[model samples]
Target: MIQTEIYNNGPVEVAYQVYDDFYHYKSGVYYHVYGDKPSGHAVKIIGWGTENKVDYWLVANSWSTTFGENGFFKIRRGTNECEIEENVVAGLPKSSGNIIGGFIAFLALIFYYMF
Candidate 1:
C-alpha cells in the first residue's frame, strides 16, 4: 500500500518533488477521524501519476484518495504553503540502517488514520 519512497542516505534536504509548488491551509482535521494535527498545517504535493512527461503539482486533502485518481485534489502550483518561506527540511530519513525508528512513527500515524 506504500508507494512513496524516502531517501535519507545522503545529506538532509527538502523534497524537490517531481511536482511543483505547495499548498497550505490555516488548520484542519486529517484522515477519517484520528490524527488531529494541532500544528494544523502541512505541505502536500500531488504525485503526478507516472507516465506523464511533466507531472502536475496538486494539493492533497483530507478527502480519501478514492475521491480523485488516488484521493488527491488538483490545486494551482507556485502557491506558498505559508508565509515565512523557511528552508526546506529532509523528509522521512532512512539512512542509519535504523529506519525503524522513523518507520514506527510513520506506521503509528497511518494506523491512527485507519482506525
Candidate 2:
C-alpha cells in the first residue's frame, strides 16, 4: 500500500485527476465524489493520520501557502480518491550526492508530462 511506502520511505509524489472541488478546498478531510470535470495535477504525500475517525493522507500542494491549510491538505485515505494512489512515484538515493539529481530528474519528468 502507499501508506506502507510512506512509512518505510518519506514523501511520495502522486499524479491524480483534480476537480473543481479540489481547487476551492480550504480545510478538513477532502473526499472527492462529485462528477466535476477533472484535470491532471500532482502533489507530495508527506504523512497520514486519522481525524474524527476518518483516515486521511496529509499532502503538500504546489499551489503555495495561499491554498488549503497553508499549502497542505488532507484527503481520504485507502479508497484511492481521485486515483491518487495510482501513479505514485518515490525513490531512495543510493548516496547523498544522488539525492538532488534524482529529485530534479523526477520533477523534470513530471513537469514534462504535466504541461
Off by over 4 Å in 2: 95-115
Against the unseen true structure, what C-alpha lDDT does each candidate score? 0.34, 0.85
Tens-digit per-residue lDDT, 1-115, candidate 2: 7878889888998887787778779999998856585588878999999999999999999998999999999999988888888778888668656687767867875885568
- Candidate 1 Cα errors over 4 Å, as ranges: 1-43, 48-56, 65-70, 81-92, 96-115
Return the lDDT, model 2, position 107.
84
**C-alpha lDDT of residue 14 in model 2:** 86
Per-model TM-score on C-alpha atoms: 0.28, 0.78
Please give, for residues 53-109, the per-residue lDDT of candidate 1 as tens digits.
422334455555555445554422233223211223234535557677766755554
